[model samples]
Target: MNTTPAFSRRSWLQRTASGFGALALHDLVQAAQTPLAVKAPRFPAKAKRVIFLFMSGGPSQPDLFDPKDYIKRMHGKTISAPINTNELRVGTDKFLALATHGEVKPRGQSGMMISDLLPHTATIADEISLLRAVHSDNNQHQPAALQFHTGVTADVRPSMGSWISYGLGAENSNLPNFITIHPDSDTRLYGASFLPAAHQGTKVVIPQGDKQSPIDYLADVSGDAKAQRARIDFTQRMNRRLLKGAEVDARMEGMIESMEIAFRMQSATPELVDISNESEATKKLYGIGEKTTDKNGRACLLARRLSEAGVRFVQVTMGGWDHHGNIRDALPKSCSETDQPCAALIKDLKSRGLLDDTLVVWSGEFGRTPWSQDLSGTSPIHKHGREHQPESFCTWMAGGGIKPGFTFGETDDFGFRPVSGKVHLHDLHATILHQLGLDHEKLTWRHLGRDFRLTDVYGNVVKEILA
Candidate 1:
């Protein structure tokens, strides 16, 4: 008798396929569980955290940091446009030299040039390393900001914070590794394109009113902790089942991980955000209750708190620097809104002994032109504003591995191009990664059959600015 027992189709398939499925499932579960867990750096790190104070809409470099006597003397006069012959010129076709809005005097022992508009920042000039010739490729706001955050000016890519989060992971398991406070409307600025979604920046807002929550949809409406847990468990099981069948779905895997994080954050985040317990003196230092500095002050204070609590990358976006017209009247308002809060953050970090390992960077996407642009063509020289200039800008870095009480880079007499120590956006990205113990060349993610990096195959670490 051919005594082989009749094998059912279901049993045969299960027996043959179950082992492979189990192995895949096990790997997926492990990854989902520890996606944000802290990872060892490739080398010794100088900075444990990064606080990027992004001045959106490009601040004016000439009016703020790199003032030129030539430009001031030739104010309102049509000077020879040093712009590239190939480049397009619009409102700035006249190339009329624009004077600084106020005096740009030497500050601190380093003689870093700072505007009278930023009095608070001037006081801490000794603590900063000023880069006078930071340049980017784009002149437009959206594209320039994109380049600043994602390395590329056009295509969507992982943001700098996302990359850092991927490289270092979360120091505090209860919080996200990357947090962007009051970010721009563009989600691409914080998105973790192609990389694991868990590495993306978590958007946070400083509550304006007593009733508002810093993060929306954070409250549990079910009001039953046990019941919520049960629902989450059920959802996770289904997600895992789907993942196991698919073998690999990065999006689904990220969803699984993010859901768990959201659940946990409900319990851990509220206390961290609450500022009622903060001392009055500390609040005053940040200008928290004051009218002019209230919004950014709260945001900056929150950034410090988040960083101190082990968040790897924290960003505070302060907008309204886009002074296309009437810059003389507009620039000081912008400076007043941001100066004190930003300076206070530096001081607070130093007081807490966090400054040594905390990298604080202040910059815009690009700087404004030294030439005036009068849209009406009838406006006076004082009323005419500057145009965008991508050739050169000013950026300042404090703490981390930077040389304090020093200035690096230089601009030509026109303040239109870098004469020396030119640091491109790529170089800036590379240097930031280097300070965090990440090799820019080695810290890459494979996407679309090739490796991609923050510097995008072009960047040299600016070693001269390093301490």
Candidate 2:
């Protein structure tokens, strides 16, 4: 029995009440609390929120960030190098070719050695810092990503974005403080679980197409504006009545805030998502035109727009990095999609002087392993394949309070594990929160009779990377 029916544009718009023109998108999803309302930082705050770029499908570290001297130590190892060198699958072979292509050289004044695949990012090396020793607990997909986004890698905690929204009220009264834009075939990437429904990212502008106007209802579902007010009032009354005896319902408060902001967005979102208002030059710089019109570029452009409009957090999620095989062939396309716009976004932010206050993070759930999955190959490099590695990887930081042009931490010669300045996922989260003026350890909710925080009991601010 096929109960699912075909979806049309009109039906889609009506079903997804969120407007198309990028209206008060954050309000679309209700949150349990506001992160902006968290206590002021003990010291100076560097950033307000975060723009997290999640590269799902785990990118390989050796091929991308850390080409090591240790690969030679294990020469003759054979594995499937998924891409350019795909035919090189073998067993019991040593040393996979350190990197598929060119070397990762020191760039900018900081001399951070980013792989050649990320040439655009190299230009701004002096403005960014790289964390080379990020190790996670898992090798699987959903679990790792979930743990990365939510503090409980075990699948039982609130997400960092959700916690931030909970701690702080929205900075923009008319918009949701936290927003996420992920272009994928699935919805779970941005779905809200225990967090208040309102706190979840409002998919203001889905990645359908230009005419889709992701925010269709944004203009007004009704001909009469005042009539809209009546609907909001009616909904609020129902919520208030439903929880009449509740001691403290953060979820309900989040709902109230969302509704209020939605009413206000009727006047704001259309303008914010309108690239027409931006200079043609700016669009060109973002690679919105011609040959560079890739999905990742569009996301980067949207991220810049959202941040400029005062969005507290604008997460641009680009999945499909899982290069278990064919890495050499896939990396070029993957790099093509991201390399340019990411760098452009930074340059644009700096030009607008927003970089100092806006923080950008590029990372994945975990890195791919140095050894091939089968552990038996003939050549130093596999046939463009790499296995899962929870031991070590890299992530980058720019703007906010991060020290630019620096590479923090180190991995063993084979890039198998972190040997210096190891920072775990929780520590990273804590540091991000610290920059936004909240103590990750202190910003907690009493759930199940215990105080649960974004960092839990572990996590220390990596002060060395601070500006």
Candidate 3:
């Protein structure tokens, strides 16, 4: 009616923004063109995949990696220690002294002091980079666990694995870029909040006992392949019709992509989880047949298989580490449930030549207190367990860019707090991203009119731990 061709919104934006809008348009075009295809990293990548062994609850560090001989000296004495929070209400002034439960001896050529409780892990001590002074802002379990996965504790955000998946995309198109096996009940642990849902982890819960089906309803039971395809096609047509007038939503696009992935996964996921093809020796290696180790062993073995099959990130969680009392019996059982399988995972990865490019991380939410909860001079074996100590803890990394057999950071004589080389959770996230050739500062997503990153606004790559 105006007798002139109408200027498109994109054209109007480009004409009014003094050329800045063109750059924004270019970025949008690039993002659309290469949504999830494998792309080159910003720099050379050392690790192609990651296997995170998340130990839920807290594990005491003094009895594990950072042993304190001085704690033994003042075992039953009341010592003045710093308590930063009023939540515990233990009065920051003085607390009862507690000593290590087991002997901590030098392991491997690195001469790192590892507890006797983790003898299996100690065997591969030379393959790990132990961070003795790892600390977190939160001491509580859910918040700390959230902080470990996402940078913030208060809000639902994309996880580190999700960030990696967003950055690297899926290696095997049939498999998801991020996979979480036997994760905690909390879905936030592997959720991709603001990021595209395609990057969200595909969760696979391992059956606890005697149940073999890893994913229920994975296979089509209709027994007619052609009919199933026709049904899927019809459903997709309806979805497309619904999507026709939407504002080019990424979430809807991601949902469509996810549906396609699920369709493809029908053929791929079954083979990935099936361990029947694994050798008997391999099963024994992972302690799959043993009652004490079977659950976690299956998880670790599945993680290995997934990693081998080119899944970008795989997380395996082992819970029940929160020991407020009776740590003597509780700690050993925790170790026994996980130690053999974890060690076997590393060894299996190495033997299969996948360790070089597969980075493995092992850590808990926080460390335990240096002092006991109760002051009564009880029996040595029955002494009350330590409380949560967020000020200092330890975590380890192996393979890829990590320096083998290295122990970085330090804690005080009594393992009360960090003395030097304190590695914050943000820094750890940054370092992990760096090892994968992603710059923490540059790997960002624009959300809520601001750039959000996995490390948030804070992170320093711990170069000292790099190989």
lDDT of 3: 0.82
Best by TM-score: 1
For candidate 1, write residues 5-63 as lDDT tens digits.
13432342343233222223333344344567565566788998999999999999999
**In candidate 2, what residue range of length 10 has the lowest lDDT sum?**
19-28
Clashes of 1: 0
Model 1: CA > 4 A from native: 1-33
lDDT of 3 by residue, 89-163 (tens): 342224667788889899999998898999899999999999999988987889999999998887888999999
- For candidate 3, the per-residue lDDT at 205 reads 82
Window of ten residues with lowest summed lDDT in model 3: 1-10
Q: How many backbone clashes can be found in candidate 3? A: 0
Question: How does model 2 fare in lDDT?
Answer: 0.69
lDDT of each: 0.87, 0.69, 0.82
Cα lDDT for residue 214, candidate 2 = 51
Preferred candidate (lDDT higher): 1 or 2? 1
